[model samples]
Target: MTDHALVLFSGGQDSATCLAWALDRFPHVETLGFDYGQRHRVELEVRAAFRERLARENPAWAARLGPDHLLTLDALREVSDTALTRETEITMQANGLPSTFVPGRNLLFVTFAAALAYRRGLRHLVAGMCETDYSGYPDCRDDTLKALQVAINLGMDRRFVLHTPLMWRDKKATWALAARLGGAALVEAIRVETHSCYLGDRTTLHAWGFGCGTCPACELRQRGWEAWAADPGKDETHD
Candidate 1:
């Protein structure tokens, strides 16, 4: 019964992978991005450049996915600073949470995404919210998502299926998923183009991807890439 899908894209490796997944499953796909004023605002630019690259190189896919939709919510400014929203040095929580864990981020994102999907007649909303590979964002948990989805659907009086392609994937597995979706070319794009750095530092490079490699996000990504490369099956998903 589902046809149209809206991807809550953030121009990161995970969201990019989700976008590819949505493209694979849906005949009609569109992207939704957020500009909620994170310090890594460069990701917005990265998303734009990615679309431009797609438009230039893969016009067919570009036409299929349509233009990237961005929502600029300044309410994050009202939210207190942690690290991602400020110029302060990034710190990690005792439970692996980093200052980058913008509270209610995924919750608000999915809720807004659901509302947008309802308005656009989209029955499926796809996002890359991985509890398997993350820095302790409580809202990324599957239970939270399920609850939020039901609440949003009830609030909107519409049935929207939220798809999380990377919920169980680690970084290495994530790379493998990307490779499967579009082969090495997609993997290469993620490595060279996507921005996942908390500090918004894309100048520095690493084996996994670009970022302040010392940050928690980078550390997890680096380890995941190593595990994936060392994987015997290589394409095997996490256990």
Candidate 2:
């Protein structure tokens, strides 16, 4: 597409992958990150480092992706009760909303991103919210996304397309797609650089991108990695 794309980047695995995917698809890409006053402050640092590294490693990519592309909104820092933002203990619930589910998080993020897009004259916005691996978050559901898309357009008086590349894809499928779009090295870079840990622990290896591996996010990530490792042939290498 010739239009620019804005991504809701969390400096995490899925979002990182989504960022790369957006880069390949859109002529211009910008990222919007939230400093929602989560329990993990290290994630913000990690995100900053990621942007810097991406700029240094690939100058062309960096030039295409400007430093001004990174936008940090601090709306959630005030409300600190949810697991994703400020809870100390993480519960692994089989069903229902997890402690990490922040109320109106995606809504706020998407709203801000949409506003940014509208200002930049960009109609496309991409996010990495997957219902399959999500921790029972209502915002990650397909219906919510569709409704939000409509709401954003109606509210902003502009037509905007919300691109959920990993909406239906499971964790395994996510890994496969990452490999396909950005290759093994890029995927590996995402795994290491991206912060998926809710607790902000950077030590040890988990099934997920990087965390205790017991958390819902980590579990899904690990399972996806295992699936990819088991069947490397299924991994796509082309766009």
What's each prediction's TM-score? 0.92, 0.88
Each model's total of backbone clashes:
0, 4
Error of 1 at 107 (Å): 1.0
Candidate 2 lDDT (Cα, 0 to 1)? 0.76
Error of 2 at 79 (Å): 3.6
> For candidate 2, lDDT tens digit of each residue in 1-239?
33888888888888888887887777678887877677766666677777666666655667667433545556565664667766567865565667788778888888888988888888888999888777778988989999999988898988899988888777788888877766776667777788877787788754445677677667777788898878855544333
Cα lDDT, model 1, residue 200? 85
Per-residue accuracy of model 1 over 131-201 as CA lDDT, tens digit each: 98787789899899999888988888888888887888778888888777677777778777888877788
Error in Å for residue 192 of model 2: 0.9
Q: Kindly give the stretch of ten consecutive residues in candidate 2 with the minimal lDDT sum.
A: 66-75
Q: Cα lDDT for residue 212, model 1?
A: 86
Leading candidate by TM-score: 1
Query: Where does candidate 1 stray beyond 4 Å?
Result: 54-60, 93-96, 232-234
